[model samples]
Target: MFFLRMTAILVLFAFSCAKKKEIYYCPMHTSYTSDRPGTCPICNMDLVKKEDHSERSKDPSTLLRTEADGKMESKNGMESEIHHASPSNDRSSEFFLSSEKQQSIGIRTELVSRRSLVKKMSLYSSVAYDPELYSALLEYKQAIQSSGLLPESSSSLGIGNLQLRLRQLGLSTEQIRVWSSGQRDPSELIVGGKNGRAHIYSQVYESELSIAKPGLNIQFKTDVYPDKEFGGKIKSIDNIVDKNSRTLRLRSEVSDPGHLLKPQMFGETMIEISLPGLLTIPTSAILDTGVRKIVYVQTNPNSFRAVTVKIGKSVDTWSEVLSGLEEGQSVVSESTFLVDSEAKIRFGNNAHNH
Candidate 1:
């Protein structure tokens, strides 16, 4: 029986060795492999021969895997079931690290808590010149000039059809009167100068429209001058929301101090929305595994457990956590990837060590 068992072990070892296949792969894309040597189709790089580690791969721990986790080999002419991997149904993974290992890995944790999250949204914007408004203003001014003395009020100065057109173009009665009286030049609206101002328009989606208002300040940056930023306050929001884009137009007036900004000049703008008393964590703490978001939470001293979490909006530095954690829980914030890889190796996922 002893000899038979020894023979069975040798046969199994030989079969495992023969199972290894020769593979050639791209160095840049290691996962892209071919049975024979050739250039990688994805990158067109020469495939490098994959080195065989037949001698070094025979680890004693891998021989047993886990007695409880897998079916055992049959004793007499019995077949053994080899489990290629651990069951993936596990939702939580627990592991412990020595203080020395933690220190060497530079592991750091952050306390998850409710805090004010100031999120900034970057959107495409441009220095604007409304053709509709320009046309209406030009015709209104021409009619007033041709009709003799300009009336004191918008109701009288821009009389007839021109007055109705101006009102429908987002120009208030007082603003139209000011423009008619030369308090603000109509020429400055288009041919802007150093002493003039420029109009900036940004599109805000319906989901974020609640945070946008007429008084909120927006910071703009143009490609022409990367270092300089122009600031402006939203002066008006269109009552009409676009059906296809589901966005509304927000218009702001900014002074062209250097007179560099021109009509229809492409630029980007930043709008900040502040949410108070929201549960949040450092953005780096969450490991996105394509299907789920996982965060390593410290359960005890030097002991961490992987917890699946649901996250809301994420900014550059902070991410809002909606579930799967408490306010006082500490999560791995720094060196998360290193810790996660090591934990996988310790918890029977030794393939990750490669």
Candidate 2:
């Protein structure tokens, strides 16, 4: 019994000796590790359990941390210090690059400034006309004119009412006057007349009603005339919105100089709405991560810092800056990808060192 008891004691001691030590590390600074549960010494972030080294090797985030010849190395194999500023810490992100290196990499910078943000909304529309309606109206006017003498009972009143009805059917006051004077040509007053212009009818979403106004310039293009852009201006906006589509009708007049814009021919219309006074930057300067947008700003001749920014409307070449940037500051525009890659490498190295 004594021998068996001694054997059990020896086995328990060996098992305790074989138990692995619990390791902890900062998630942001993966290299900063501790034997006990605590916060990271470098970033002050909560230290989490360090999984098996074999499991960590499978993680892509850990790929930036490499081991070479008894030293920790960055993915780029270069040793550099990268300062990462957390908003909570109130520190600014900064790094260094030589002027010669900047030129070699084709880095370019532009000053952020306030500018008007013009948003162009586009929609499809077509030229349309109703021939039967115009024909019936013309016949009614002719019949009334042919009855040369008025009836004795309320004759003048009857004529006045008929003339008013004609005006309501889309006849201009001048057109009605000319018809009364015995100058009547149905084709002259109808759509697709000698005026050489076409009416374009488009629908604007209910949400866009605020921006839809008369006299706004519209440029349209058709499949038939792919190389040409026809110009027009908004003539009217419908008072009612379609219940089914929740859209409002918009009418415009376009000069059909070549008569290529035919009735029922579909085309795309573009209208620009002016937005006054917003900070903007070139679209090329922004680097979008999945969660945040980054821009590199030049603090000195050879130093650049990555700044987080909030962006708004984007026009052709510029994007509205909603926050995280100020006017008169210069940001790197060209070769931004290279700078970002270098910044990541430096950040990894610095974190590893810490």
Candidate 3:
């Protein structure tokens, strides 16, 4: 009877040793381990079963699987989820959302495309005229027309000087021809009245002087005609810069049909210039926090990921993309903030629970 009792006792002890012990850890604090399950001391979060860490460490290519708390980490200690990681550094960046939820939140997306971006610059200007220059040009035109009656040698030398002076005063060959033929008066061109066009004089800073040239379209608005927009092309750019303001003078001829745009009338001018082909997106799609510019890209159906992008000049409603995004990808254009908020709430709640 004593031998049988001893044998039963030994068998019970062996059976207990064979059963594996369950390991427990805090979901919020994965490093915190305990032999028995309980609330975490630091965060007070409930403890959960600790899965075998060895399996994850063995496969470096495998994705870090999330625990019940939605917390996931790779063997190398890097975050694996797209929504929770920094957009600039994360390689596998993506998040999941249902189609129904996306619609409820009013999320909308647009495909990225290559386009020729146009940059517009605005400048304040006023209508101007030079009475002395106009008078000199008129006299120069008469001298050239009457030079044919003088001695050939004297006419050649005298008319040449007068032509040079007229050119220096900003009279074009076409204008000289018209005035010499009595087709139009040189004074009328500078005075700008019933039958003439007004001259819009604007200043371009040193930074913008390179692009300031003739033939660029300009739209100007004056305080007198608040509802009207006057259109013209850059007719001339001065070679000299203003010593005080450090700006180059540019002139555009605008038709003054109503004679409302009088000399010294202040106005605003907009000049549009086309840029090279570049990737672009809507300005409304970007969430600018000053520190970083972020945009949500749709990776899959109802799945979105935050991406960091470098932006260049912004024109009107669109912006130039410099880097961090690919062409032909879809990005969330509307209600991006709501999507980010939802991701945080949903994932943050799960991260604390067992």
Candidate 4:
């Protein structure tokens, strides 16, 4: 009986002890549980309570201690010197230490400005005959010639009759006299008319034709203002192509609001249209890496970071900043990449805590 009672009491005591012990487990890993403080099997991290005490401590109102000047303060504003970390110069340290200093790339900058001067380029074009219009004009001339109103050959009539033929062909009296007196211009007779001759000037030059549109914008410059601009709207496109140049001559009539532009003066011309929402960046702040463009951003004092960027057309020296940048962020404009390299060197030198 004594042996049975002792065994029963020992069993009850063992059960009580087992009930008093607490179990701990990792919040992330439910499979890991332990009675003593130790790491989880899978994660190899110290097993923590399933419910986190750090989570409840996050509320500012529940904070029990405050720190000022590197010292922890009690609920009562007591002051104590904080144990400041010593400067480290460990070169073999592996983990990253986020410090106050940041690195960045240096770059150049120029503000956008407007000027009166404009760059221009010149183009040489020739006058051409418009087959359609030429055919029409020729047909009209033939109708009158075949009707006997105008003689095909002015030599068929006497001088007076020739004069009459010249008039019929749409030639003025002056033109008829010039034709009859063939000593000066023999082709004058070519424009002879029985009624009136339509004077034909052999050296007549017309503007290029706008095949795309009946009318087009004409921009040109003349010798008067070698650097000024003159622009005009297309009056009409000649329905002809120059046989010599093989290009349709287009005539653009531009208005001279400033009247600085004049006729017959040679100048450069350009065609441009509007396209919006294009990305751009400052050209001065860029570092060209044979394959890509780069810029150094001032991430923090003494820290410049190298970043790649896309570039677009330049407005003067200021380049259109494209991707890899945000507005209002500061960047090192002058030698920013060099600055970044220097920063990296400093960081590597100070990588180890000192």
Candidate 5:
């Protein structure tokens, strides 16, 4: 009798211990496991396994969280009555996509002729001269020399070592003769003369001497005649670059006279150095993410997928697809962002789907 009582007591104690321990269930993931847990292993829901007949069914519709108290309640209502509240509703709420839809805004661009253009950088520039005072000095020399104001010995004063002395004394041939000729008004000569003779300097810019350097080719378009396209190849580039601006003054000759593009016009340039069979893609097909570039490839009419890509140089409307893509593959061009969103949600990212 004593042994029987002891065994019974031991069994009762084990049963009581098991009953006191709690279990857990995940709210979002119901298939995960927890042992002696307070919350679910996957979803953090309080796990309650009841022995009652009402609590044993796997029908998700029978399980509900009552609004009055935060606890799971089970009941059997008409199947049609709770059809609106399925697990799909939970997923829909989690991936709220109403705001993720693409806007109807349009991006505007001027289309250029389809040609093989090499990408290049172009900048707006101004026209300038090196020296401006030479014209004034030439006039001063001619006027004084013609006025015949100097002595006969001075008449032959030009074209020798003495001309250098005359120049140095601020006495141009014109200024000395304007005084000797007893001219009523010699202010122009006087202005040229100053106190003594001096040298004058000037600069000119008739034809382009900088942009036409040998072997360099440039294609340009201007905003003034935005529709017109111009092309040129470099004849020469100045060996001395501008110290202030650091620009290599180039001289280029346009083979086609139709490209009489004016100076100081805003333009874009391209230099095409062809490499054989470089992989490229239409720029329209790319989708830009802040962190990584992406694109959507068409798997089927109703299915698409998002793929991250590495990109290289871009020219006009095409981009160099470095990786994550292959040649001859089809992609969503006009609606890539919209399709990528849908693909992410379908593939279980829970991201917003457009």
Candidate 6:
């Protein structure tokens, strides 16, 4: 009988010692933690029990706990904290987090600012070979010669239908006038091999027609001479888009001093467009959810709101923001996926992060 009593006493003592000490703190002044619950000395508000998030977040069915959401006053005039799990019935793009949880997730942010943007386009090009185009140039050359001066100021009566035929062959009116001035020989269209000039044919997709204009400089690289790059300028762009391919044809003139470029040869070309003073952000900051773009803005110390934004051209590390975000706004830049995961857990299928 005495042994049983002694064992029971020992177990009771150990259990008492292992029990976790209760902690309390004023919600308005969280820095003040205490062993006993009462009014806080700093904020003079009633203390509330501190919650352990590890115990709360483990349950997948749990939504979110709104701490200090409201206060209920007692007969003694001391208030108590109310923490409740909210279903978040309405569609809201914002999510809130406590200070400690924010640190654990490694949340980072950057300001949206105006910066100069340079957009680059990469395209596959082929050295051109068109006998039809050569024939048209031959006719244009004869018309110019017959007119003697083929005066730029004169009407097109001397060329007959040759001007229209040249247009159909992709030569702009400006190019026809230049050739008639006797400066650049039109035979270069067909016999450029002797003069060291190569015609290159490349097409741009319909979506990029905004930047497709004549005179834009381009750089070409060919497999024949892997170490060299040739410079060229756009001579003409077709007025019509190819129905089957949805692409606009582009014709360019390249200088081949070493006679290295040959007809029907495969090559690559790059076009660069420089834009100034545009609102931009780090390319990785925008989240592409397969449809719309979303970015998180920190509205408070531990709060963030998801914002849908329209995407624009990207240059280097920065991407242009057409609409949605304003200059000098803070956006989440680092560890965005982790923050998004937490938001998904809180909102379930109703997440509007995109």
Query: Which structure among the candidates has the greatest lDDT?
Result: 6
lDDT of 4 by residue, 25-113 (tens): 65335546788878877767566443333443465453344333334454566543322222234222212212321222223433222
Give the alpha carbon lDDT tens digit for every residue of 180-247 in model 6.
Answer: 67766655555454466787889899888777678999998888889998898988987778899998
Provide the lowest-lDDT 10-residue window in model 3. Answer: 345-354
Per the 3 Å backbone cut-off, how many clashing residue pairs does candidate 1 have?
0
Which lDDT tens digits does candidate 1 get at residues 60-139?
A: 43333335734434334343444232343442455556567677768999999988878787877888767777777778
**Model 3, span 1-354: residue lDDT tens:** 999999999999999998767788664455577989889899886776654545555675765656543445766776643233323333245555666757766888888888887778898898876686567766776677788888899888887887777666555666556657776565654566446467788888866775677889999898789999888888777656678999877777777777778777899999989877868888888988576788888876656677788987677778878897899999888887766654444344332121
Candidate 5, residue 254: Cα displacement in angstroms equals 7.7
RMSD list, candidates in order: 11.0, 13.0, 12.6, 21.2, 20.1, 12.4
Candidate 5's clash total is: 31
Off by over 4 Å in 3: 1-92, 115-124, 129-197, 203-214, 219-231, 235-250, 255-261, 268-278, 342-354
CA error at residue 273 for candidate 3, angstroms: 5.5
Error of 3 at 109 (Å): 1.0
Error of 1 at 55 (Å): 23
The whole-model lDDT of each prediction reads: 0.73, 0.70, 0.72, 0.43, 0.45, 0.74
- Among residues 3 or more apart in sequence or in different chains, the pairs in candidate 6 whose N, CA or C atoms overlap within 3 Å are none
| Alpha carbon deviation, residue 314, candidate 2 (Å) | 2.4
Candidate 5 or 4, higher TM-score? 5
2 against 3, candidate with superior TM-score: 3
TM-scores for every predicted model: 0.49, 0.45, 0.46, 0.32, 0.33, 0.62
lDDT of model 2 at position 340:
77
Residue 164's lDDT within candidate 4 is 50
What TM value does model 3 have?
0.46
Over 4 Å off in model 4, which ranges?
A: 1-219, 224-229, 233-265, 270-280, 340-354
Compare the candidates by TM-score and give the number of the best one. Answer: 6
